[model samples]
Target: MSRYPLRSTLFFLCPLFSGLLACFIWAATLPPAAAQERGGGQTPSLGFAPRPKESAPDKELRFLRDSTAAAAISADELLEDRERKRVIGRGFADLRFLGKRVQADHIEVQTETRDAVATGNIIFQAGNDRIVGSRIDFNLDSERLVIYDAKGYLGATYYITGNVVRRISVDRYEVIDGTFTTCEGDKPDWAFHSRKSTFQIEGYAHLQAPLLSLRGVPAAALPYAIFPIKSKRETGFLIPTIGYANRNGLEFSPRFFWAINKWSDATFGVDYYEKRGSRYLGEYRYILSKDTAGQFNTTYFKDKLEKTTLWDIKSSHISSLPGGWGFSAVTDFASRKNDDRSLERNLNDRVRQDTDTRLELTPNLKGIPGSLRVAMRRREGLRENDGDLFQKFPHITLDVSQSQIGSSEFRYSLGSSATSFYRVQNKKTTVLQRFDAAPSVSLPVQTVPWLGVTANFGLRYTYWTDQKRTPDVPGNPSRDDQKQSPLSREIWFSSLGVAGPRFSRVYNGGFGPFRDFKHILSFQTTYSYAPAMDSRDRKLIIPIDNVDAFNDQNTVSYGIVNRVLTKLKTGEGFETRQLFTASLTQSADIAEARREQNLSANPRRPFGDVVLDIQSRPISLIRFTHEAIYDPYEHEIDEQTTGLLLEGGRNWYLGLDRTWRRKRSRGRDPQSGRSDLNFSAGYGLTRRWFLEYLTRINNVQNITLQQS
Candidate 1:
């Protein structure tokens, strides 16, 4: 047993010992050799596997490999065929190239050709555009895509759907069998369907064979059309205006605008009235420079109901020239086939058609301190029964500045004019030529801050050439007579002297809403004198204007003025403003006393009417004005005018006026007077709504004369 046990034990122990020795040798030798073989004779460590030594070329190669991996396209599922250089992906595949992204349920890419195809719910996104298509074929390098059955959104306001769409560039696209609409819905409010369309980003869409549909109903068709997708100024059709008027009935006006250039534009409009006929209107606007702008408009209408043709032309222009010269012209001319009854039905239109036209040019004299104005004017009446009309074809005037007399206080000025007047009545014409000139000199003296005086002396001369008039002619006067009189001349001299004294006082810290209040009082007296010409000689002069021979008279006019000023705080800053002005004027005619021209067989009274004027702005939004002439000799009010204006909240305004004039002679009733009351109000109801009313009432008759 002992021998067997020993042998068995020895056998187990020997095998165990032999296995442990072989394991140690195998472990020690195997690790070193394997490490040498794997790491190029480098020792292995227990802390971590020894890092392989990298050379410059290896480092560069590894960096390149990592960059390539980063730029490579990734997908959830990818199937690659190396031989064909093709890749196929399914289930939520997405690819990004450039700045755009493409997503689809299934995608196929050709690596060599740099092209891709996507099907089943494909979406493409670039910039603000997101396009969805059933199938898409795109070139990766070229960034060109062809989408089938695509619907895309441009910005947020526009939508486009097409059977096929080709992306030409980032800002351009070509669509076939497409519909474009600004409205968002399955059923759009308005849409344009085109067989072929080309879109340019933020510009316009060119459509071939476009049909305009409203509420899914085809409303219009065009061979080719350009739809503006921008808010900038472009040549296009404007929205039509539709309304109904009582006089003109239903009206529809459509306009077309043409942008000629950056400085000019034109609009052509057509207005159709159901009761009346159509009207064509055209307007042209231009701006040549900063100081030059103009507009010309014309309207032509043929009324079928009234069987009349009406036309009106209006033009206005203002231009500033070099060397302090300016030009302005306004022309308003209208013509009708018939009388006022057959003219425009609206009162405003009738008034506009009867307006006058004028043109003026002002030029600065080079060496002289003056300006010259040349004007042309024309007028035509449209009333049923009107009298003769006087018109000036062209008028020229010169106004010179006041010149000093060698540092003296005396200044002189000259004003001259030449005018041609034409009078037409009952198919007859009369012409008159007149020339006038006036020169004046003034001397102003201020002895102190409260005392001032001004003396003015003037001479006026007028010459006129007119047809000779025969006295005691039994029949009507013939304006076509060839007889002419010699040029008549009238000369007059006048002098005026004014002396005044002004006084003012200021009070502070007492007035409400005003920091300082001032009161100014002034008293002035004016004395005018001229030698009268003979009455018989004055009868020979034909007056064409206001200049006439002076009457033999010595007059003294006295005026008293009171003005109130205040310094107040406003929203912007401190302001100094005038609050009210009150004035009273009266004159005494001394020459009437010397002539003894009193018809009442009483003492000759020299005192004339006393004029009272008051203008007051008591508050920021209210104004009151009163003017009256009181006859002190007769102890009566001759004339009176009063006005009140109120500007309130919510853009509301109200104005009231009262006027009264006394009759010169009392007929049966001593209190007979003519009086009128006018009331006007305007209110803004809403942002785009307004209401205005104006009415005049005759006080004596107790009736409304006019209301608008």
Candidate 2:
């Protein structure tokens, strides 16, 4: 000690030895630089020794350097917020602390006039995304922080070390210019690079001039783009259609829809064809309540080529109408004028048949105007021959049955129609005002044993006028010679009785020789009377026109025909009594039957006929018809017709008919002709094939296939 220069020797030599020992101990016992500040402390410097920026070799810095060795910050202040906590290290302004406990090895810190920088190797964080980069920087006063070329980790996952930075109280940024992506870290096929980007502290980002490359090709390029921070709904346009059709040529349809209220909406679109022009359509729908809704849709087209117009309108209201009344209306109109007159030749003569208006109201209306029946209807038909005729018009009807007057067993209906008809040939126009009211009277008189007598009365009246036609023969007595009359009257009466068999018999066998078979016999009789008188010169014909025969008593004309049956058991089946079994028929010549004129001179008198039918198995059917003439005094056979038909299923079928006229001749080659025979037969060859033969010996031809 005496030889070395006392003060210098003690300062330099002793402190140097002490610093060496301290360095050795720190390197051995303390945690790594990253571990030293792992929890909360001043981070140890690595890349560069902790040092304040030189200040012009100023007095204060020099004084501080002389007064104390650099103020050493402890590891605790390294991880704490320097600005908010207002905590500072005074003993050491620039600090370095190497640690032995944590995993990382490198740590760094630098201080400048306005900021402080800290950087190090960030270790693998078990649950967080891993990043690897070069460096990180932080501004103390501004509380801005940045990481540069810093590599971070979570387990084995590591990202490219470019930037993973957060500037306190400022913003965050992940520089991806040199970034590589790998869903499988071994061999990545895609990469991303961006010139610059801004990211919110909350984690959303806006990138600039970003390029996404896949398999070495530029997948996407965006000058600027924004990404949503959360999931949300989006609005956009739809794709248009492109297609072609033969008649319509090239076609295109563009459609769009808008969602408006929760209960209502609309859609509109257009259909365009290069050849046929374009059409537009729109639909609107609304829900008035939970149970009721209304919808309307319409379409229209105006052809540029032909100047034709077409449109359809439809409106419907569902069960939601008031009082459970639903309404529907459809109106469609179309008119097409041929683009070229020659085109009409290719199509059928096009006559438009369209309904001008169609309205349907249902279920006893409450929502509709008046009642369920409060409606007006109109329609027209167009035909080449008819030109234009009002087939139906605006006819209105109301429910008048609230004053329900008819019996429950019967119904009373009253209706009227105003209509017009145009004749094609004569070109005559006729207008009609028609009224009808039918109240049917039915009285069922049950007279046991005697019969069930029923009386029914029907009344029908018509008032009309005709533009009378002048007869070709001026003096002819035919109806054509009569002039039109304004008024007329007709009165009719009908009465009938229904009777049952009082006595019945069954014969087990024959009528004569080979005619033996099972037979059933029953007898019944029905009587009817009808009289009609009218001053209407033109007598109205009914289903049956009554002719006089056995008159004075109820003629078998208006009601049921009277008959007694005697069924005979025969080999071919039971043979019916041909005499009594005939059709109950009346004459069409009302005036002639009324006079009942018969005699060689007046032999063309009206006649009444009756026919009977019988059928028995393979022998088929047999019919016998007899006509009785009325000469206003006597009844005799005027005409008789017999017909028979036989069939054996798929094997064969045969039919024969004969007719005989009964007009007296008086040597004039007989006023009436003899019987004419007609026959037909069919025989099946197989299940689905057949042969047929037919003949009308005295008349026409007829033939057919049976099993085809």
lDDT of 2 by residue, 1-708 (tens): 000010111112122221111100000111223332344333442122234455222333222123232322333323333455322332112332221011132333333343444334533221233333344454423434556654332122222334454433332445544443322222234444566555443234455665655445665554544432111111112233444544456766665654566677666778887887788978787887877777787878777766676665656665445766666555543342223221111224233343355565556644333333333443433333323333323333443232223454432333322222222122434333322222334455666664555555544343334322432322212344334444233333344545443333444544443242333233333344435443233332110111111122234433233433455557677565522422233433444556654555776444444333433232234333334332333444555566666767545777777666654757754344555666667764322223465444442222221111
Listed in order, each prediction's TM-score against the native is 0.58, 0.31
lDDT of 1 by residue, 1-708 (tens): 000000101112122221111100000111111111221221211111112343112222221113322112434566777799877766666655545767777878777776889898888777766778889998765657899999877543357899999999987888999998765446655577999999877666788877766557875666665654542346655545555554567777767888788898888888898888898999999999999999999988888877778777889999998988999988877663435332243657645424467888898788777779999887665544244455776799998767887787889889888888886555566677778888888888887888887777877776677634643321223564523574544444555555458889998764776678899999988888766655554554444446533345588989999999987777886688888999999999887767655556867778988999999986778899999999887798989999999987545899999999988774546567899999989864321223577678899989877655
Worst 10 residues of 1 by lDDT: 1-10
By TM-score, how accurate is candidate 1?
0.58
Best by lDDT: 1
Question: In model 1, which regions exceed 4 Å deviation?
Answer: 1-260, 266-282, 299-311, 321-325, 335-355, 384-387, 425-429, 467-483, 490-492, 548-553, 571-573, 597-608, 648-650, 663-674, 685-688
The lDDT of model 1 is 0.68
Per-residue lDDT of 632 in model 1: 88
TM-score of 2: 0.31
The true-structure Cα RMSD of candidate 2 reads: 33.8
